[model samples]
Target: MSFEDKESPIEVDVQSLDEPIDIKAEKKLIHKFDYRLVPFFCVSYFFSSLDRSNIGNAKVAGMATDLNMTDAQFSNIASVLYATYIPFMVPGVWFMRRFARPKYYLGTMIIAWSLVTIFTIFVKSYGAMIVVRLLIGLCEGSYLSCMSVIATDYYFPHELARRSAYYFVASSFSGSFGGLIATGITAIKSGKLESWKYLYLIEGLLSLAAGIWVFIFFPDSPHVLTVTETEKKIQADRDRRKAVYMGDTKFSKPELWSALDWRLAVSIVIQFCQDICLYGFSTFLPVILKSGLGFNKMEAQYLTVPIYFLAGGLYLVQAEISDRLRKRGPVLMFGTSIAIIGYIILLAVKSSAVKYFACYLICFTLYLGTGLNEIWLASNTAPAFKRGTSISLNLSLGNVAGAVSPQVYRDAPDYTLGHAFTLGCLVVCLFAVALQSWGYKQKNKLHQEILESGVDNRTKSRKHGDDDPSFKFLT
Candidate 1:
């Protein structure tokens, strides 16, 4: 049935042509897509990451001193954000999906978070601070998963990794600008408002603008976008490349049970491990540089600028290579290994230069594995509902580590303990990546076998894509 019909074509079979896949046409379509969707989302994401990580910069600017926050109290405030972040994730994604267009829900939530960022200026007491952090996390809990789902909806499986990388790298670029801005703002000692408050005010206004733009301009979906007849044909061809539902479709018991298996379990562990490091670095890097490595706050902020630049550059390279090679596993393995080396060097070194270099290595792939694995799971899972849930599960459970990360790094200025904990998590995550990669390899192998037999389980289940005998895992 057509989408116009009452019966949604969400689960309806979309058949591919007998003719060869049109590689050139698809590339052109994807390139055209790059200009339309990537820029605004990148700008939005830049603000999201800035608001979240700028706290580290704020800490150095004396937010802690002004509020009389001890190490433990600051840690609690950091972890409290994750309290709502975890529980609301699945619900948040569900809510976003339920909306007819993203601007209503996603845009509203972005604006909401930006308002919360602005509210930070009013946080005089510890209790008020806690409330603000929690509110921010609640508003942002669904963003990553929601964005991932939107990406999968628009792009082919192979294209998603690079597209996602584009979204993520902007966060890295924000670090460069966020640091410089923070450095400048905190230097303004004459103002009635503190430097951190200025950071919030500026970044929040930028985010509000971006959110409003999204609500006003973003299409409901790629299917609704105005395109030529040739573009429509190519899009239809794109639809046949995957089995995910495009409209409202309920998940069956079998589909749900199949999805909530060892893969999900592994993904949860991987995310848990991943976030401990991701947030650990984002939360503590500025303080770590100033306190532990003997740099002043301004010098530390400048030092951080280079790391973000390197991180964005490396991520683009990593994303390009992974997309071109059509393998997510190697990237995960390589990123983890580089991070491990960075951590080990941090522990081993006493020189400021050596320690700084080590941080660049860790920063290079810090956000990469998390982003890559999200795509890996989304592409390999069948049906739209399953893919959405998988993304939510990864994001929700993984973020719990964010709560834990602050405590481990609680002994900041001398955060050897935090570095150790993050190193341990990265190591465990490496193993998870290996096992997950092996699972994909095995699944692809079985898919080939079943295709030759012509008695595939996919045929029996009447499912396609990851469920199809011909489908192969990206890794």
Candidate 2:
């Protein structure tokens, strides 16, 4: 059924393929894509991150006490979203891969999750909170996978790290600015709702507005992008070189096997290790600042701004480095090493002031490793289905750490166990990075030997995606 679809053909204008690429037109069209897509994605994701983690903000604002919840129950609230999110991610990506209009599909997802966030305002009991969170997980589990695929639709492999960074950094934006937003909401004198309730109400409405705008304006696919005929031709020429084939939605069994190789296994391991930190530390950052570091409530809410912003800024820097070097593993290795030092400080340092500084070091690789890892997998994988499958698998299995992390951080003020465990996970991530690097090097070597023997690998790559010996993995 996937292959039989007329729309799935890799159609390019024949005449345009013959013409020399219009460099100026290409630049203009890329710029057009940047403006049209990036802002909407960044805003949509900003709220998504905020809604997912704002329970911490709400907890600090007295939601736990008001609802008469225990620490173990609060921990369950943190972990339960992943119970649904992890299982649903693969199917979500499948639905997105088959969906003709991604804008409509994604807009519905955004609207669904935002409605759940608004409903969070009325959760007066633990049961209500768990239900709403589970609903949100179901709605949002596929989001990252869908967005990553949508990115490949418009950008080239080399350009993906920087572009992905643009939206992915919005998680940090939510952490930094969400604190201010939450703090501001607390100041409002609303007799009808608690401060935490206002936090959900305001953030949810803003996300809803963004969803409506996306449904009305976002492009369905690159085919529907508003660009000149000359630009379209240039795009076709570029598509021939892409890891992901534009307009070809068919699932190839060969590509599936290729996607399940050792490289993907290593990538999955790295993602899981990286996410342990992402979910554990990023979600509980406000709590760490308030309870762990002896900061007062308001200070904790506001202090997260600089730390989160610094992390976002640093991830962008590393992304530029990764793009320029055209290497993912080296960047991953470098950033992870720095964060290892940070974690060491966090574990060993006794001074509160020094530990606070160590938090900044930890933030260095917080977003960098996870975001770049996705870009690496996307760039290295082939065809739409394979890329989607690999990403879904990577995220779904990897995000099980999200379920584990909240439990590790069960002890609030003295998070020694959490710090040590996260540091250990970073060590595991480094080992996985080494394995990926070695695996890519060995495969590329074998491909080189095959090419030297005059093998017809390009034809295979063209037909079967990354199975060709001539196609090099982006190491």
Candidate 3:
């Protein structure tokens, strides 16, 4: 059942085949130092996140009263943005794969969304606010999916989880930063514009600046970078090695359709349920602090700062552990289970101090699990065009729950129904994680069986060539 016993189609010299791949050497020589890539990705994500969640800050700074809207109406505006996002998710990735580089696509989307965000400052009515938000969602949908695809292009499967974690952590900081920025802007009482309007304008301008920087510096893929010839060859070697290991290099219609099998379908469903908990908590945290804990605006915003920073920090830690272990299922399950417990406490506890502490626990648990989700999906997918498309599909479909989560807040200044709904969804997330873990274990067992038999087994009869081994699960 060992890897040594497998009869692979790859015509490597027996000696070389027996030697383990030197991952460290590859990382040092091939990847070289690309400081710009991570910064560009992180900064772009920070702004994207800031723009998306500024509405939460706006709500507390008098946006609701100015626009003559109720809490439910504000929630509806949030819901409408997500509703527009669902249809654009898959198509945006498809477009990225076809017409443009991912960096360009992602940067352009950022600029567009930021512009839409800035336009929100001019809106005078609920209808106008809804229109601006819808545009913002439509423009912003491409950034996360495309950024994930770009990360996989730069890092190997084993390296993906930590990088994914970093990206999510950046996003979490953006959420935290948005609140802090709102607090600072709200403190300026003598400004010509209202605090809420200034929040949108300032965040939007920051996004515009970040978008420009990304467009200038970010490389499309490893192959397109301005590295030395030796580095280029190493990068190509790494890409080919990944393709050979994964068993495919291009997207095929049949393979794409097959990848959406029952297992992936269930993962998407689990993601949907998880997002309800995630978006609900993140989008409404400030509101919860103000109303539930009876904190003033500045106090509530400052309290939100540590919660998001801790959440981002925990995500990065979890990602590093997951990548080091080269396992996805266990990490994901553990993170989700932690989130489930946190939510349960939030539902059952009565003390305000206990509730605030539980909020931190909830943020940590949800975000840590989220980082694992990105890593798991990105690692399992085949490389090349299919990887981008498939990851996008998973994220986009999973996020459809965003459209439904805000509705759970209606008929509630208490938001009790929303919390109960999230708890139920977390239970479903637990089941889904268990199912995915079982599937991964089953696949690994079958591949081990084939290795033991010394037969060139193709479980689903995928293409085998003279330079490739049968695909193996990372676990």
* Tens-digit lDDT string for candidate 1 (137-175): 888888777777777667767777788888788988888
lDDT of 3 at 6: 11
Instruction: Please give the TM-score that candidate 2 achieves against the real structure.
Output: 0.92
Off by more than 4 A, model 1: 1-22, 243-248, 456-465
The deviation in Å at residue 443 for candidate 1 is: 0.9
Q: What is the lDDT of residue 4 in candidate 1?
A: 12
- RMSD over all Cα atoms, model 2: 3.6
Each candidate structure's TM-score, on Cα atoms with residue i matched to residue i, is 0.93, 0.92, 0.91
| Per-residue lDDT of model 2, residues 167-250, tens digit only | 878889898878888677657666789888988898889888878877788887665774677766766666654523333557
Which scores higher on TM-score, 1 or 3?
A: 1
Q: Assess candidate 3 and give its lDDT.
A: 0.72
Q: Residues 1-475, candidate 3, lDDT per residue (tens digit)? A: 0000011112223244334545575566534434647778778878877787777788888899899998889988988887677778777766776677666778788889888888888899999999988898899876787777667666766777776676678889988898888788868788778889999988888889888877777776666663776566656565555545444445567656656666668768777887887788888888888887678988777788888998898888877888778777777777777777777777788777888888876765566665577557666655354455667788888888777888886644557888888889888888887888788667667656766787755656454321123455554
Residue 119 of model 1 has an lDDT of 80
For model 1, name the residue pairs that clash: none
**Rank by TM-score (best first):** 1, 2, 3
Score residue 437 of candidate 3 by CA lDDT. 75
As a whole number from 0 to 100, the lDDT of residue 398 in candidate 2 is: 90
